[model samples]
Target: MTSGIHHFTGITADVQANVDFYAGFLGFRLVKQTGGYADAEQLHLIYGDGLGSPGSLLTFLVWEAAGRGRTGIGQVSELGLAVAPGSMGDWLTRALTVGIPHEGPSREFGEPVLRLKDPDGLIVKLVGAEMATPAPLNGAPTRLRGVTLLTDRASETAGFVSRFGYTNSGNTGMTQRMISDTDILDIREVSGFVPSVAGAGVPDHVAFRARDVDAVRSMRLSLEGHGPTEVHDRKYFLSLYVRDPVGILMEYATDGPGMTVDEAPGELGRTLFLPPHEADRAEDLRAMLPQFALPGEERFPVRELPFVHRFNRPKEPDGTTLVLLHGTGGNEADLMPIARRIAPRSSLLGVRGRATEEGTNRWFCRLDATTFDRADIRSEAEAFAAFVEGAVTGYGLSADRLVFLGYSNGANFLAAFIQLHPGLVRRATLLRGMQALENPPAADLSDTDVLVISGRNDPYARDGTELADALRARGARVDFRALLTGHELTGTDVTEASEWITRTLSLN
Candidate 1:
């Protein structure tokens, strides 16, 4: 049977940044700096209380160039670590000294938690708890207090956890707390939030401790009906993974063949360690990895929404800049031609969506064909807005002359952003778009000029009209046109949109 949490695995944008925050700031020991078992090019790092103990371990798979993740339902929202009682003040002091932003030494479920975000935006909570012994390092966490899984399917997840020997400890508000002898799992029930996207700063998987390979195989058998399972030899430990009903990645791992298998106890984490399979290519892999260095006490400026983008300089440098956003499954260059056709003289900046769904890029997550993730929409909007601000400064473009060109999912994101930010975008051309939020933030769009084009037979056509009306009610100058078509972009739609862009730019 599975016991407590073995370790929580996450994805990070930078390995050195992760080490600086987890080991340098939090005082956790850097137990292992290794390459991923499956991918040799990716760096895998382990941080723990001491000697990389099972319950104390927190691992990260680092990719330096990956975008930020979307945190919502079907994901582990927060990771909790056990700390000695009365250590919250020390942790807060360390956080301030290290230039880490944190919130709350607040009480939750009878425990004090000092919450902070890691470099990649993963939630880390140091909870005050009665520990058996003091940690080796000052302010280092004792052990894993388990993870909080955010899901709409709370009952299903609770039932699934029960099969792994966890018992329901009842609810605190809308959260369901489950517990075993060594682990505490919190299931937060969320509704109308977007499904999670796997990216940098997201918890990749939560692992439960198993006795051995036999126990792992047996657990896999029990998880047959619940979800699909795949067993893999991780060299250090045997692992079995499954996606729960709500889509959170769960794993069962053995705690044998520990960190000392390759490096000696005294020399642990002093040098880069590679698995046997990857050892042959160590030289090549090392050359490809970014330089690892502990950041100084000064805070690093982390880009909120780093995107793959292309910036095109206009033939005549007009003060007006056209920002192009693509729909689902489209890349940064996907909307370039349309943007060029509509505003040839305007500077063109095309951005790719950060979130992915089954390898397809999407601006935000969706619950169903008709339902969108409201929380993710807001998060992506804020990030996108930040990205635009950065672009404006980088390109020496005026914010007042900015115009947004978005289609379908991209258009929906613009609608959400304009509602949240009000006058950030002076003008926008939304193609086949609809409202993303049921109760959008009330803002004054009186100075905004918007052109909304909708397909008559599109499923969200009504939503498109409603959004236009909503904007108009907020005093925006909205020109809405409905064409006799479906969800796809039409030639007539483009022609009309081009005309609208020309007229809007002229008036401005």
Candidate 2:
């Protein structure tokens, strides 16, 4: 009911590392370290400018356990921050001066926001706002103005947000309204809900505006991140956010002189935020964060998983249940970005391989090229079957509603699964993974809709065109494409796959 960006959350294995990553590298100030509402031994970390504005705060649950919590169905998608609109190009120049991997200074639906994922996969959005109030807290040069959450029940969340005077805006029935005395809070609820598995990308919490330390403390009385809340004086703005009902982390932010006090607005994101404690040694902090801007936006919004943010989260959308598997060394969290982008209309259940390959994630055992032990395949296939059966039964989906999406090593096992269980998957999306299975599976893909995307320059493909021809000869209703890419995935490449998937179904 209160205004501001607050109540953002997520789970993590290491709290300090997470904190360092945010406060130090990302330029967020450490405003508080509170007791965990769900777990006491577990700590809650709040990082943001001290202004105490909505969307300026962020909350976290640093679990004592080694296992990571899955970001899925019952979670917020991302924390959208309103930044200098049209200044995305300007932000890009500054973000590059510092070292950060940016995905876009691009558009989401329509809003121009920068998209960056935190160390643990939580998305943080930064967009341009027309009427940002003068910040109150002064901890970081930058401050929080507002926050947006992508949810399965946008209407329900908006119902809660509207309690504070927010209204619905956007062409897609999104909720928008002026939250503060003037700041606008935009919330959109669409059919864009994608169900993710335990390890998939998802939001755990979010925080809102914390006008002052007392208000932050008052908020701490009712919020989890406030238990051991730390007070900061960043000489810019002070802020914080704690955990919420759904466990997604949040933050409270504020803005007065803003990040531009030192540099111009054109240079806002070009530099990093240094906390008061680290301010004297700001140069040292600046040297620590990654030095490459991975080519996208300048100051953008932090989205949940791209898939969760881009597509609708559905228990069952269009009667199909899309199962996604990740590659080795990576968990289920990594692939959902591509999964959500490639198929915004399908319901997704992205999976992480059960077996850990020493340090990396893999579908099955692989000693080297062309060498896979049957023991690994058999066990993984069995696990795959069990996983498939459980998902289908749990979600009440039939074979016709089941789809397969696997990357490199993921496809290795999936191809094996298709060989082992002939009619399980109704459609298959195999990207950069078809090679490991040189020969066709024993089963026929006639009834199944298959989209095999290969990169022309990939060494793994041997020859991409030949691979496409081979699949067509196998009697599969296949739509094969060879893009001018390597094994690496790109947004342009993803768009091609998305178009193919749409056409695949439309033809049917």
Candidate 3:
């Protein structure tokens, strides 16, 4: 039967540095050096035990020039490697000798754990376990012990994973530990930390073992009752990906057609390998990809703040532009259609929220459903304001004609950003958004035009009025409406928003 983690895949900035850390320092074998199956331009490298075992494999999709990612909510915060009991001393000595920055020889759930950060700031924990495989490197880590999933909704995530056969083992402080027959999982509820961003040094997805193709198919059917599930043929395995209640990306993958299927055992990772599907376009893909070579002991400079965004120029270019921001869990492309429907001729700039909860994107971290982290809100707002400034200048668009259109969390972030940089946006449409700042910023926004649309029956209905009053108090012209619907945007909401945009633009 499918057992524990088949592999944990993450993004890396420099493939050479990654090789140096995992293969050179830690002494894990490079099982397969290949190109990305889906995106052939990126490098896909795998590190594992002597044979590239399922539970031992750590995989990375390297984008050499990519910027450093922010670690936040809605992401796998830590990857735990299981080491033989009493081997913590040896591992600690190795880390110190190599100058690896680390913390904690602390004990959690009665297990000894040493935590450290990789070159790109991804957390790696060496966990002491009796059940781990015999280490190949000085009796240190043998296989992946488990993964730590950080989320806001811990109870919901715990319940969901339990439904899929994980049993609650125990809890250490705020972390809930779960055990499957073949693997261990930990869930930590984090509030107030910055939400995670996707880029280099972020664990993108975690895959569980499935017995075979039929087991993977069955798991997909079971997961549908909870949320969305997508099945893909990975060539080496058949897999299904799903997001839990709080947004952690979980994959159930079949165990057959192992890593050695394509290459010979002895020469597994010696040369570049491609999936069968991409074999035809290998030459073309190689031309586009950046050339790589083994590391020579020097570290590369880390680029900061990887922001995911999309800018679209209108076919019939209007002087005005719409900056679209989507709700929590929505991507940059999510609000493009809405922008087009409202302002067809206007250029569009859609920004993906950087903070993630589990796998869902959020503008900032929340203390709970109602309370927000004001500090994080302020930090992200500053970053977003800079991003907007760059976009306006780069796209050759007038800052005066740019209108901000945001929904829910996106709208809340806009509320915070506008308060700090009031003149940056002259007009904005906030849909079902609330005041994100704990203590509102004092700004003279006399000439600014704002429209806030909310559902009367929504839980955050009061936030709409609070935000409108706050804006009005600061001398801005605020138009507030509370429709007869719930939290969702209805046809009436869109119609009203379109009218408001027209009236506001015409006046300007």
Candidate 4:
């Protein structure tokens, strides 16, 4: 049986900030970026030493927009990483240089420790001691040293961990120190403490290393009736999960076919890897995942603009830029997958709606179920126009090569923008959209090409046709197509939009 910790899994609400701190600031090499085991929508990031050894891994599940979690009983309250002995001062200096607030070179467990919190507020203790793993890269911490598990039943938890070769080494106050070959287990007894909440920044589970598949199975058999044990094939490793007596989640994972199983060591974290089951929805998954830039990389900086947006530069550019607008309750990243499918080589710009209704996002305020607030529409349109102008200037994009794609509420806003500010957008695609303006001014759009795709059974189909009519009256060449669907988009939408974009680009 393999001893010591395999890895610790935690939660992070902001993927970009988390990556910046762990991979950029802390200098931990990002070994893998993949979807979470339970849910493919949330990202799972693995950071470790160069080779991504079993005992050196720290993983996080990206839970965007989740609230902060409470750290108390039945939770891993702190993560400890090992640095070379006598390196506490240098680590503290680095933290200060990076503008990260940290506390103390205080002595803990007879070792110097510098304490800090991750972006999501997870406590991290950088201990002064060399770990039994690979050498540190970029002066990053060597490896995982220990984890502090707060629980009311510390003795029971200690007994449980002892099954996996953790022997009680010593104690300090209310904490019992258990030692395995490569990791330490600090079980701190918090009597009558509240159990931890499941949210961002809280440790989800702690995994122990298993020698192989047979070892994992043997461990599962040893704990045949312990709470619940379910084995899962995690592609890189076979694992079994169970709950300890104190309700803390625990796992035994195989260490072979490790982090480099799918990706080369040099290209480990550059690409996002999905499970075999989700291979079919690869493009959609890639688009849905949050876009982030590595630190020191020349990328679009998130600025304080009129509209919140995300930009994705393709690995290979075709000199075309597509600006995307999402529907009601949708965000900037919502339409990225569709945009990528339509124009794979084009740069994608996804802009979020500014207005909100009952907590959900909208391009403009609606007066009622079927009526929109015209004043709000006009104000937002002007702001959106300003954003487009600024984005073109800031991103150094060619105005004539910008193609607009909008859906539903976003499409309605785009329709208003075209009418109110003609000659700005050269090409546009409206998906399940309608006219937002009750009475529109006449403007010449002779230089424009538009595609209006509405669902045949959509409630807004009649209004969408009127929008197409409005565009055509303005002298804009329009390709109107109705698909057999409802309000939601379909694969046929991608097909029609792609074909229309190709035709327009050819003409350009």
Q: Please rank every candidate by lDDT, starting with the best.
A: 4, 1, 3, 2
lDDT of 2 by residue, 1-508 (tens): 3465444556665444465556655556555453433332334555555433334555566542245445454455555655556666765665576655577877654658777666666666666655443453322224444455544565556555453345654444454433555444555443455543333234554445445566655655654532344444434445554433332334454443344465553333344344444445443223222121212323222222212111124324575556777777765445654666566556656666766556776777776766776667776777677667665665566565567777767766775676566666667777776544445455665666667777778776545445445445555667767778888877866786677666665655
What TM-scores do the predictions have?
Answer: 0.59, 0.43, 0.57, 0.86
Candidate 2 TM-score, true structure as reference? 0.43
For candidate 4, list the clashing residue pairs, or say none.
Answer: none
Ranking by TM-score: 4, 1, 3, 2
Please name the candidate that would achieve the greatest lDDT relative to the true structure.
4
- Candidate 1 collision pairs: none
lDDT of 3 by residue, 117-211 (tens): 88887899998886555325454368888999888888888887775468889887889998887778899989776778888888997888888
TM-score (C-alpha, index-matched) for candidate 4: 0.86
Q: Report how far off residue 480 is in candidate 4 (Å).
A: 2.5
Residue runs of model 2 more than 4 Å from their true location after superposition: 1-59, 62-65, 68-319, 437-441, 464-474
The C-alpha local distance difference test score for the whole of candidate 3 amounts to: 0.79
TM-score of candidate 3 to 2 decimals: 0.57
Better of 2 and 4 by lDDT: 4
Q: RMSD of model 2, in Å?
A: 19.5
Error of 3 at 69 (Å): 1.5
